[model samples]
Target: MAVESYKKIETYKASDVKTKVVDTDVLIIGGGMSGCGAAYEAAYWAKAANKKVVLVEKAAIERSGAVAHGLSAINCYLGLSGRSQFTNNKPITLEEFARYVTLDMMGVSREDLVVDYARNVDDSVHLFEKWGLPIWKDENGKYVREGRWQIMINGESYKPIVAEAAKKAIGEENIYERVFITHLLLDKDDKNKVAGAVGFSVRDPIFYVFKAKAVIIATGGATGLFRPKSTGEGMGRIWYAVFNTGSGYSMAIEAGAHTTQMEHRFIPTRFKDGYGPVGAWFLLFKSRATNAYGKDYTENVAAIEKYKPYANASPVPTPLRNHQMIEEIVQGRGPIYMRTEEALQKLSAGDPKNAKKLLEDAWEDFLDMTIDQALLWAATNTEPDKAPS
Candidate 1:
């Protein structure tokens, strides 16, 4: 059944490959935020049990996954310092957080999981601040708020700080960087149980077989699976991490793990071409996205009604907001723009003396997170006060 084109011109014997076996009490795949957090927590319990924890990363943990480049804000933080317009100016409670998540996800979210995350996310944020990540604070020393649940941060070194702590906790000897896990190894007697994993090094021809008592796959999302707008050389310029190819999902599915919502994917709107983050502009700066006619199309009741109750939800669901924008383009109001100049001018008007500082803050938003956006601005000689992004 094999095609002639699929045949290799040259082949090597199996003996030509090198294999190494590693045994650990817990095996963690991927080195993104989730993997690093898992390793940090697992190390404590692992050490107490006198067990070994091994983490394998396809790339270096210091600058890997979604947070590799950096971030301008901690998008999730439910602490006493947290303040949100959606929360009615009070600290967000566990129940409220869970409700918000459930609503935002269109009731597709697990309430128990959402509550658990809400309860502990603040501690992690505090830990990040304690670990030398500068969280922006107001004059009263309260953490600056950026929309609901988000806090401003000078996060150029966010991953490095988290990765350093995780490395220290897990120990340098246990980490296997540059090792890409190909698949999970199931127990021979019970095929449903995961016994270990198999991978190979990116640097060498050596193959790795890890025999873990338990395996944790935190390999982030399955980006690049769908066709991207940018093709060829610019193909890698996507909103999400390009390296995340759903290897974990594939491995788990192959081992008989059940899954749902496989067809559903979160599509976010970003700055045109550069794929720059629009969060800071929308949430922090309170910028409005308008159609080519300079109309705030999000206010279009007709479009919002199509998505029903989800569109009417507090803060409005991300998908619904994107839907309105897409509807605009489909309706011939193409080339939608974020009212950046209007937002900047309004913010500067409030603090006329600090206009220059405000401009720096706007630029820093892109610089700290998506450097490409800043580079794009530089290339185009963009002035935020003069034009929209």
Candidate 2:
């Protein structure tokens, strides 16, 4: 008798769950990098065309998504010309950039997309600056280059900057924060087209259903699909944003969209134990990687052929570098090290103004993107001297 009464009460509570309805011309599912971009454009265009726009985010847009911690550098910038002197000044054409990208993916990358990204990346970055993103610029009044096609930036508060811009484009009321979208709604007559989506508030039990003419899903990349090197209690250790749990992929799959490139995993060879940012060492400081015998294995490796024409590109393709590092390890030349002394000495002895600017920029990079790791470095008096695990 008591069990039956409890079951009836549970059913009653379930039936009492709240459901909220929203209608808009355009509904965006995720609020990460891609989602924010889509929402910003959608809202802008919708306003121009006199249409309603809605943005649904799983968390607060201010500190939500992958770039919440901030970014140290902007990759794929056209910085070959106009900028003069911290050191090397070389021109990088789109073709050279495309070639390097192709080599990085081992020829599996979408070259067309690469070219398109290269062309538009700078404009988008500049727009971010216009919206209050503090990009580091040199005394010459040009954006400071961290490496070829890369520029240093203080992007710690980038999320809020972009989110505020989005809100301004679309009314603040149109944007929904802390809404975890569960599934997309399909058109009744034509199942192929997405009608809208349904979600629930992260903080409350209120269920949300959005009805719209179009939907966009941009929840960033997937992580935690496969186990990392760390096992047991630390198995969750991973480099990518942990929040991106293949939600975008799953949503697309349910919508009958074909997903590809599952085999291509970007397994980065990073620092052991902590898995700190590796790009900072080489890209910002111009550190070189040497094997056990202090031999520069990167130049002699077969992978070097991939970036043949642009062999000396300031920052080479990540995958190509990782591949070379792994080869050295497998060949019994196990230990590898980032030779930073030469770069450090140069930085210490170089033009005071340029050196000060470089260190400040690099320090800000560590503080924003990887504060915890930066703290670890400070506590232990360590640098990127050891080989990547």
Candidate 3:
């Protein structure tokens, strides 16, 4: 269902001139959430079997990927909020949470993995605790069981405590930083199973190769597409660990390992889109859309009423797009871009001010999503003053 969600524009850059390699038991790539998880799991598993493991990052620690703002509470939304009674509330398990999201977002159930995921989540939580991750606990001094999930944070830490633990697990000798792994080395004979990987030093300019029995890719999204101000090495324009592309996936694919969650990418959003991409994409995943007049647009309305069980719930940038296409002037917060005969009655009595604010919020999100100088361009292209980025 990725279905042309992103409009790809052609661009090019230079490639690696020199290359080299090394050998290891396990090589974990990327340092983002998934990458971190795999690194910890592999290292711990290997240690249990008395083996070796290594985690590689394109840049230094604390850069590249979602750690841009570090982590605090897990955003699982496990329990219902705004409920008055505390004890009456029930927490959600990992399986239930995954089921809800997967069903609502993808229309298919992740039934098989949910059980295993639920069984092991507690272990992952404690893994954070053992790594000096601070957890907010209950009066009894045990880890607090609230909402739907656990967290190891107060606010933002430049060094997410668990990240420090990951480094320790790998150690200076095993872990390589400031290295860029552009491609995963494969078994040339059968073209199956990972033989190792080939990346290099961004600073030293040499092939940093690793011949590993297994490789885990946790390196994150196609970053640097949008200019994000992340930590340390990422501060470089190429902060994307530009060198550490999708070698892990390619290598695995070459080795006959197929990927299931390939379609899972965060929806592009703009606050100005008002309903937010979640609502729109949810409707789309449900295979529905709306009318231009803003009515309850549905492709197959009759079919939806039959299913009642489900419910629901970045990034680099260039400028912004759309240029405030909503109704702005007569609508009050309407900005006139969204103006239409249908919206007028709602505008007359329906609090245009609030509506306008909503549109503005949506518009800001538009800028956030599109990164097109829409608002700024709006001022030059039209009469309205664009909001500052």
Candidate 4:
């Protein structure tokens, strides 16, 4: 199992490569969830106005971007059907949701943007349900709430479903898959206006020069900027999509777009080794993250008080939680563990059959969202209910 060696590959310059030019009313740069969403919206207006829109994706939209592997839960739903206990059993209001986001970002969030997302997020979720994604509902016909705003789903085909809708709306002929956009083209007369974009085919030597009145850059965030824990074959094993290398941000900044919060980055504490999401374990399975000494260090009020209001906020901010864990590791109480065994036993309520079922559910959490984690478990014979991860 030797790691692949890096070697020189074929290289091409702007003058050497063949270029193809396309003209359209609107051009979309990325084909992630944001890109697909933009395509869907742009298509509606384009059809109404009889304007042409073109969408460019580095990979196929159906299984591209961060959602390619699927998600076990939709983490941003604010439906009235199922109220969260964290909000005191009341429906989470737009203002409250805005506040939560702001607090989460240490009061650095734009209230307007949060409000806009809060208002329309439910419609998107409803649309997802309508688009053949199975959303889990309780016996009471209410969506099953996982956390304050999350709802469970059999979302293994989430991106594909969304991509299908986008493809239908935008028309498949307009989308250019496997074309890697390199930069945004500025208008010749007005430097502030983006005229189009330039990219190249990943599968071929042909370069693309897309000319449009409007350009939407929906490329996701950056990953691998900082060195990861494992730098060999596991270099790609990160919480965020490895393909998202801040190309969108880089293109925008290069095209004179002002950037804010450049330093603000989210470092999620995922399951070790495989980098699996711990949301379901924490919220749904009622699991606790403990230090080497089996202490729930997040409850250390003294350390949390330093973070002030954010720490006091319901479901303490992600950064603050990471801070607590880091402190534990820094102070020689290293090797923190997810108390999966304890969580499963409590969830099963001492029933052997229920425990077995709960164990299967635990595995499904990883299999549905992160197959790597399930494979890791299999490779190591890691019975989650028998040992902490």
Candidate 5:
């Protein structure tokens, strides 16, 4: 199909074009979480200074980027006081969070960046909540804990909520939907500064040339660079948004931005056929991941210093944990199962849906979170049956 399309495009010329121009003070490329956040933040400041802010996304901002399906967990947050706390309680300190992150990464993290993120992460989550995101709470009216640094949330409409907020801040007219940015434009006076960008509409052949004083590139990561475990019928069925092809990274590299950590890539361990996250079950309901030998491998390695900090925490580092799990599999211990028996039993004693009732109320959230796998479960008539995964 690609070959046929290329053959037809052999006679196509760059000169056959229609042009549209947009002038703004700040232009944001990519309508993902970061991009939308930047747009709204810029608009917040721009409103006081009477400046224009524009955002262009390859896809619709309402359903684009990594969190398009929404996230059940806010992984990096201050314990419970920051935003979720309704009283005048002090939140976790920036230094404490930074130290925790450094320890988690085995002393190989940027302290300054971690501190900054820790300081602001809760506010971001709170903003989403203000815009109509629902955080799960317990019987005592406290926010439910997914892990030490994570919280459960009803975030199926996360993208749309943020997108709507960004639209309100910057004005809906300033947003360009379905615009595939090909490259960045450098300023004539100083090459160090970005002038604007050029792109084409994904739905049409119209060409676009945007001119702005400053540009923010916030497209998410690339996934197709490495071969996925699920191949053949389910080639692009792994975690991370498949639509996120790392175009922003490529554009930044081409624009001569100093890049780091290119060699460090995380290998996520997912379910066998469906490829959905198994960590959530463990984190949310105290589920255990056992191997073919019916032993929890993570418990055996809890004494290791590198994993000690997260020995009690759910959702440990994927790269390291996955390594340990793989080693166990290679050493004749395969077929790991994410067992949620205790939670299932408690739920089944009264609730027929079991712990899945949390999902049943927000079924769209579940479907969006696990697009293919949830569908696969439905198609196969699979039930939780005390062992959800």
Candidate 6:
């Protein structure tokens, strides 16, 4: 695929999507690292065994799934040094890694065991190599060790690369992009084996029924449903996609299919506490995070006098104890989360004096950026009751 190929496939607003029914075998939902890995494995393996494969993704297989953006890593492997510093003679085996992970891991740890990650150690290296990544060892005959057994390579390829490859191996006619899987069509007779699936396009929400001997659901994960402290879609503009909102799980549940590791994999995403769609996107481009009180968060950090403000703001949002603010508003101390429309209107009707100051204050935070005069339009309005103590 060339750079021009993707530009040709416009991610037109879903409202513009045109969907139709299709057929396929094996549908795997979730197009993140695991999802793409599953697709690459299934498609290529089936191709190796001479089988037909169709992978359905809610979003363009790239930029939406976990692996779509820029993430070139496979930390699920074990180290022979095992100590993480490259102990040349101490080659770690699957059993050793598994025993360490499962045994010492107490409450909840995503760390892999030796046996589990063992096979993947070399297998993953091979997988990268297969994907055209030139992985190599260090001059000392160990994985190019840096901060630890953390081998750094030219591996910044996104998960979309695999989808790009699968799109080729599986043939364009066989692949359908932007198709959402809403339900698993169970084989009426067997009930256990899935014969096909049904879905619609978010663009139109029309019913798209697909039938096949074996159906796969590649619908990714549920994210963007809430604002995260980091890069969450709090308003559904999630890090993943809006379509990943429980559709796959809903389909599986409706079909009565049981899932394993649900208990373990049921961890909430990190960095979603203070995230909002408009705030998250704009902050990355220019502005920085702020407390509900409209305080400059970066300035607070810079005043700490302890650490050199690690640049402008802490690389990550600092979780502050804004109890007085939240309590005053939420518990009727100051303002409330359920601010009435009237209150918002009043906050917006601020005097020109403070309005310009607020926008200028925010503008002063980020380097080399400007907040349009229009952004301060809302500042003129009355704010929701301030968080009171």
RMSD for all candidates, in order, please.
Answer: 5.4, 6.0, 12.3, 3.0, 4.6, 14.2
Q: Please provide, for model 4 over 1-119, each residue's C-alpha lDDT reduced to its tens digit, 9 standing for 90 to 100.
A: 99998876777776777879999999998998999999998998999999998999999999999999999999988875443233346788788788888888888778897788778
List per-prediction Cα lDDT, in the order shown: 0.84, 0.74, 0.49, 0.86, 0.74, 0.48
The regions of model 4 sitting more than 4 angstroms off are 1-16, 80-88
For model 4, what is the error of residue 207's alpha carbon versus the real structure, in angstroms, after optimal superposition?
A: 1.3
Over all chains combined, what TM-score does candidate 6 have? 0.55
The residue pairs that clash in candidate 2, if any, are none
- Lowest summed lDDT window (length 10), candidate 3: 314-323
Best by lDDT: 4
- Which regions of candidate 6 are displaced past 4 Å? 1-19, 48-50, 79-89, 103-118, 134-137, 140-142, 146-150, 204-206, 224-243, 265-389
CA displacement after TM-score superposition, residue 382 of candidate 6 (Å):
34
lDDT of 6 by residue, 272-368 (tens): 2211122211221133234455443334433334433322232321222132233334433332222222232343466666545434432332111
Worst 10 residues of 1 by lDDT: 80-89
Quote the positional error of residue 132 for candidate 4 in Å: 1.0
Q: Whose lDDT is higher: candidate 2's or candidate 3's?
A: 2
Judge candidate 1 against the unseen true structure and give its global Cα lDDT, from 0 to 1. 0.84
lDDT of 4 at 242: 88
TM-score (all chains, Cα) for each model: 0.92, 0.83, 0.56, 0.92, 0.85, 0.55
- TM-score for candidate 3: 0.56
Worst 10 residues of 4 by lDDT: 80-89
